[model samples]
Target: MTAQHPSDVDLFAPPRRSGPRPTTTGREIPHDQLDQFSPPRIRAALIGHATALPGVFTGPSQVSEPASLALRLHDPRGRWEAFLYPSPDEFGHIHRTGFMHLTVPRPIIAPLIEAGWIEPHPITLRPQWPDTIVMLYAPRDEDELALATAIMDASWQQATES
Candidate 1:
């Protein structure tokens, strides 16, 4: 057997096409504001799922222009650390899409595509935080609200009892 160098692995592969581009309702809530609504435990719970969703990161002061939130997601290939822009201005993409792309190394994009967690979107770099790629998910509907409320209640109950 021959020894393989860690650098020998090929990283990037073309993204798999998605069916029917995702639609957005243009609804949005800032991550800090979410603290008033019991935080985002709903999204936090999915961290263990096969295709993990990212979590919102908040800073000390209220988010102003050019704000960014660091996020963590899991794909088949590995864990990805990304950034999401929850600002109300240019970074307000989260308000529109309900999700944001946190760019992974070129190599990890294929895994995210295969896992159905992300697809290609506009790529822009923030000078302050060079590693972040943002994507916003679609706005939540009534069905999602009910489901989230139920999940949060169940989680709260479990936590209190434990």
Candidate 2:
């Protein structure tokens, strides 16, 4: 793929997602995040972690349905891609299921997805919802939380440090 369409290169190539893939309704607006819900404490911790990131703020999603918690970046690095968003670029958002929606870099995507850490957002095939936007499944336990944190760090590094 050309650099101009860097995101198009090997976008879905893989080792493949490890283990069982989680269930999703495959609908963008009502993107299903109901199963595998994180415990309340864990959800709170995730929100705290997501909110504390530099250049980010938490608020109602401008585009998502009501009550959706979204994190918008003040000045996005745009390393994920300068693709248009329904609103300003979002860094990520935590869902009721403890899942996260993030703008992850393309190169690391295969490893992350193949590792069973994340999956493509339900509507990734749509013109606006490119594959760069991925869904990070909820961290189910402390061990998974640790993994989740590392994944967030990696996602952020790709977003800000690339």
- The C-alpha local distance difference test score for the whole of candidate 2 amounts to 0.65
Q: Give the range of the ten consecutive residues with the poorest summed lDDT in model 2.
A: 1-10
TM-score of each: 0.30, 0.75
**lDDT scores for all predictions?**
0.30, 0.65
* Per-model tally of clashing residue pairs: 14, 0
Highest TM-score among the candidates is held by which one? Answer: 2
Q: Which stretches of candidate 1 lie over 4 Å from their true place?
A: 1-21, 24-41, 44-57, 60-98, 124-162
For every candidate in turn, the CA RMSD to the true structure comes to 14.4, 7.8
> Once model 1 is optimally superposed onto the true structure by TM-score, how far is the C-alpha of residue 118 displaced, in angstroms?
0.6
Q: Which stretches of candidate 2 lie over 4 Å from their true place?
A: 1-19, 79-84
